[model samples]
Target: MTGRPATTTLWRPTGPEELALVRALDWRAWPPRLPEQPIFYPVLNEDYAIRIAREWNVPHSGVGFVTRFEVRSGFLSRYPVRRAGGRTILELWVPAEELPEFNAHIVGTVQVVHTFR
Candidate 1:
């Protein structure tokens, strides 16, 4: 309630090419870690993180929220969810020029998840 609104993009993937882009981005941004495999946590690559923002179904002025969970003592603990919407959760701001490319990646990823599975 004290700062300016953030910006974002919402994209829906339509083809395999787009999906491949998204997957590539995801891999680049968040390389997999064998140590963390027990929890099945997705270590999203930076590129994929951007794609997630573009693919998120929210307004341009919305804020993005990213969360990480850890299991301890046979219990799952959740990180706090940010309240702002339309904002990307990454540490750096994604350039406007890259929005289109990121959106394409997101759309492609979604398409693959929905149809190919």
Candidate 2:
């Protein structure tokens, strides 16, 4: 809880807008939220991300993005978590401002797995 929580490397699937924003900001960072978006959600694993991308983002937006990044696992505690699919995957909601700190913890490059087009 003091001086940055323990970190873990994790992957998050992103949406087109988030993809564009992160790209504009560089892989090392995440962008600010829109007026209506109080929280920024990043899923906990590749399987979860892919599901969201395919089932939700792709169906609705026609494209979904997959991104890999590292962040503090403990930091996730401060947010609300929704575990699904027999707890094989989860999602966390982070306030917009906290995204900067989250992005700073990335261990390596944030890669685009592919667009689910």
Top model number, lDDT: 2
Superposed by TM-score, candidate 2 places the C-alpha of residue 8 at a distance from the truth, in angstroms, of: 1.7
Candidate 1 weakest ten by summed lDDT: 68-77
Residues 4-87, model 1: lDDT tens digits: 223222222223433354457662222222342322222223344435544651233243333221112111112232322344
The alpha-carbon lDDT assigned to residue 20 of candidate 2 equals 84
Task: Output the TM-score of candidate 1.
Answer: 0.22
- TM-score, every prediction: 0.22, 0.76
Cα shift from native, residue 21, model 1 (Å): 0.7
Off by over 4 Å in 2: 1-7, 72-81
For candidate 2, the TM-score is 0.76
The C-alpha stretches of model 1 lying farther than 4 A from their native spots are: 1-11, 27-113
Model 1 score (lDDT): 0.31
Cα displacement (Å) at residue 68, model 1:
18
